[model samples]
Target: MSNTPRTLFDKVWDAHVVRQIEDGPSILFIDRHFIHEVTSPVAFLGLQQRGIGVMFPDRTFATADHNTPTINQHLPVQDPFSANQLKALETNSSKYGISHWGLGNPKNGIVHVVGPENGITLPGMTIVCGDSHTSTHGAFGAIAFGIGTSEVEMVLASQCIMQPKAKKMRIAVDGKIGKGVTPKDVILYIIAKISASGATGYFVEYAGSVFENMSMEGRMTVCNMSIEMGARGGMIAPDETTFNYINGREKAPKGADWDKALAYWKTLKTDEGASFDVELKYDAADIEPMITYGTNPGMGMGISNKIPVAEALGGGQASFEKSLQYMGFQKEDSLIGKKVDYVFIGSCTNGRIEDFRAFASIVKGRKKADNVTAWIVPGSHIVEQQIKEEGILDILTEAGFQLRQPGCSACLAMNDDKIPAGKYAVSTSNRNFEGRQGPGSRTLLASPLVAAAAAVTGVVTDPRDLM
Candidate 1:
């Protein structure tokens, strides 16, 4: 309706529009561009071919994450391909004069984690990276999304990318969440309810009491998984929670600038009468600690529930059968008591300090299952430091679990922390696609609490049961 006010997405998108073409995409200015080793090499090569320097080097930040080894990062990278990619990133950042946080640097960590922790991600900004998880920055009310190598080049050359605006959707989860449930569980439940492609062509805004009660770290975990459900991105409107989280961060504004920024951020919410192209609502009490049974994130269920029979799946039965076949599962089989070979509790999705604390809470006095190989990684050096200061590392060690260095370890098989072939892992990462954790490795995505339950019992045990 013409009388309806603009939503958060409209305000941010309209503010960043550099130019609107008559019949084509708008040229949108990017406020922050994050580059990681894995995706920036080709884009930098393109820049070299064009002989064009980066338009705004100050707007871009580079880091080595996907290809960085979690262990012995002080030593030289062992894999030749990985070593070259890291080297390329260093070279490109140096030549382009962009700020880079390489291995051994105090700020070095996953780009998504490091950006927000260091205040590089601010409210009302347009952020992009070559990685899909860039949507994580949207927790601060920013318009952040993933871009391809070509789009990377476009941003580097002109600080702008041509893009069509996404339709708006609002997903509201209300009521009090039950015990043992985490933000990871909330997002997983949503994806399972709507299917993987449910939010396609839309930018989603999360609202209601559930998100309002969540900490900044918890909110990041939910927004980080937006890409898994086929949404362009997801965000939460800025409020006191957002302001408090950003106030004293390293890159956040200071003094008068802080006051000015806060005033503007307060106005970034959807108006009372704002209309959305689509809307979804859920009751928080209905969600439980969740886990995936098949190869996709949407193929998930509450930990206490049985997998749906083929007739219950909306997709083609053949495809559903193939997913089950790959996961070594039969229709309607319960996941409880199923043996697990590994348990990984880190990733952009659930690698924050809160995630570590949750895992430590579960494994404090219990020893890990002898058959389970548990990899507990922090998202950043700051988180790693916090774990030590909070004594979480000591509790983990006493429980027979090792705390690995900061990096995107085991989330993907890119680094040294890969699950062996044919092994099943209970992972807290976003994706569980075929071979996502390693060649022939089967991934059952779950919350950190669920992963902790698997680590201690060596099976797909319900977290609530352990509680």
Candidate 2:
């Protein structure tokens, strides 16, 4: 490998682009593209209005997810908006000669879930999607980020995107996590410390002892929320966990090709003397079980801590006060004991099989709280199948948890799984924006452990308490 002070993002990005313009952004060649049912409609419509077919049909992939119900994914969706959106995607893909995996297809699932599971997401590639959490695919040492509809149109036509090289931020967290602390906690703590807009317009590269020891699932969980911190994307160097996860998948390279892939992946890490635009350090031991108390995601505090008072609001006091009024919360209230009407565990963020296993572990022997309604939706049908194969479904069912169909259910509430207005919900999904769960619904973002605890206790409680 060259001794230039290069990072993984630099390597992958340079390898994918054809040329760099003077005083302009690099035009990166995209190797893989993923599209969901929700965001592709407008982009595809733009393509049709201009009478242009997708330039590289082989590189573009489509899936009927995001709006497909987790329970019954059969013909005729229950939500008209969902059905129309999915149908539009199907028609667009067919006309544009692009491949699409629909509801009944074995490969169908959430766009991000299917990409990694099918082995299409690999190191040293450029990935783009219209959905913000598209950063999830960057776990494989790829340069991945979300784009606007117009940018999507640009990508579908040229298989390349005009992109500016973002400033890179290095966040290093050392030490081991305490028991019951997961990657979700690590990210929430980072966001809470840095605030939601702290990393805006920057690419975040996570390092140090904690990330080095993390599994691929853990890495994905961190990268998936890069946007939550206002980052363009987040990534970690490709390692054994990442390579192992890619190996043996349906679309992964095999035999000699696999050896070649691994060799190249091994080269995709930061050079010893590499410098970043910004650097921050964290102590993993200092992180706590965090919960959101306001509409925006950054309004978070430790579970055992009470909400921030006005004097503690810092510069965002006005916005914080507005958020409190919308959520009907008091400044001195403890997030730990807040009553919840619903508990949801799933999303591209925490909807993987490992997340389900984590939830099942905590709630298996107990029953759901009497007044709480809980829905556990898987990220993908593949995740759903894994839960069944692992017998996690039975455990959740026995504990009075309903296993909902795979989709983004209640994550953004584009379907019928919305929490009623004035009712509180604890969710594992990323984002806690105003009406993020539904129009006028209140959401408290937490980790899967916290969601599982709320599922059993009917209130926002610390997972440490449950343990």
Against the true structure, what is every candidate's RMSD? 1.1, 1.4
Clashing pairs in 1: none
Cα lDDT, model 2, residue 384: 84
Q: TM-score for all predictions? A: 0.99, 0.97
Please list the C-alpha lDDT of all candidates, in the order they appear.
Answer: 0.92, 0.86
- Which candidate's lDDT is highest? 1
**TM-score of candidate 1 versus the correct structure, residues matched by position:** 0.99
Query: What digit string (tens of lDDT, one per residue) describes model 1 on residues 237-300?
Result: 9888888888899989999999999889999998888889999999998998899999889999
RMSD (CA, angstroms), candidate 1: 1.1
Query: Model 2 over residues 1-467: C-alpha lDDT tens digits?
Result: 46678877778877887889889988889898888787788888888789887899989999877777777676578767778888888888888888999887877877877888889999878899999999998878888899988888888988989988899899999987887788888898899888899999899899998998988887888899989999999988888888889999999999999999899889999888888989999998898888888887778887888888766656467887899999999998987777899999988889898899899988989999998988888887789899999999899889877787777889888878888888899999898888888888899988899999998998888898778
Model 1 misplaced regions, further than 4 Å: 1-4
Q: Top TM-score: which candidate number?
A: 1
C-alpha lDDT of residue 338 in model 1: 96
Off by over 4 Å in 2: 1-3
